[model samples]
Target: MASDGASNNERLLAAARDDNEDLLLDVFDQPGTFDINYQDGLGNTALHYAVLHTSYDVLDHILSHEECDVDPTNKLDKATPLHLAVEKEDPEDREYFVENLLEAGANYTIRNKHGETAEDLVKPGDEVILALFRKAQADADANMDDIAYEDDDDVASEGSD
Candidate 1:
């Protein structure tokens, strides 16, 4: 009856560009995929769409909502949001999302069953992306250092106990 407004594809595309969770929720909540490919091309639930879109709003919505599966991967590709974010173009923003996912236990080192790490997908010559990836790797490595130190400290403290 009313103008369909944007084409469904266009609407879905906008949901990514606009990066609004509330709006994306409405769009994805409908019958089919909000654009999650892991669940199947048409089956990639709303949460899956949010990651690829890199929409802060949509991402937040998905992360907070328990139903929004954070780990869905494309059947053939085996790409999780972390994998998507790693592969996606935005260096700074995508890296930020990676950090969040890692905190959530999203495996940063996970490969797509092809024996490739998230590090492999990054643009090799791109300075920004490479730098960001390097930083993340360093940070992950540092966390391990902290654990080692904590273990040493615990052993020392145990002497007093």
Candidate 2:
């Protein structure tokens, strides 16, 4: 049973690495498939592999899954999916991947083993990528502020009651 699960997990990782959307879908349909956050020996998750090797479609499928973790850190560099996204060589691909990861709630503030956040990994002269990180940070901060206000309103209403 354990080996079966391991094999399924390996298949999941391979599907993501190979951009095999069909195989990924098949694996996800199976009973007792690996946890969405399952890490290999190197602590790399399907999310990490998807970011590194997949085009938008496979990555999108992984991100759209309810249990998919957008910010899993690997063992070697403790790098999250967002970290790998920033390292994509093509500027267009980098921006697209980073945007999707952010939209899926990848935290831009997470630091890797090297103490570098995804923002820190942005290639020099890539102001557009940097701007995306800043915008995500701003949006997150605004959401936090809104939550705080809502909490305060709830407290006030309870006191009034």
Reference-based lDDT, residue 82, model 1: 74
- What is the alpha-carbon lDDT for the whole of candidate 2? 0.86
lDDT of 2 by residue, 116-143 (tens): 9989989988998988988898999999
Provide the clash count, candidate 2. 0
How high is the CA lDDT of each candidate model? 0.62, 0.86
Q: Candidate 1's residue-wise lDDT over 9-51, tens digit each?
A: 4455456556755555666677454433224354454445666
lDDT for 156 (candidate 2): 98
Would you estimate the TM-scores of all the predictions? 0.59, 0.91
Cα deviation of 154, candidate 1, in Å: 1.8
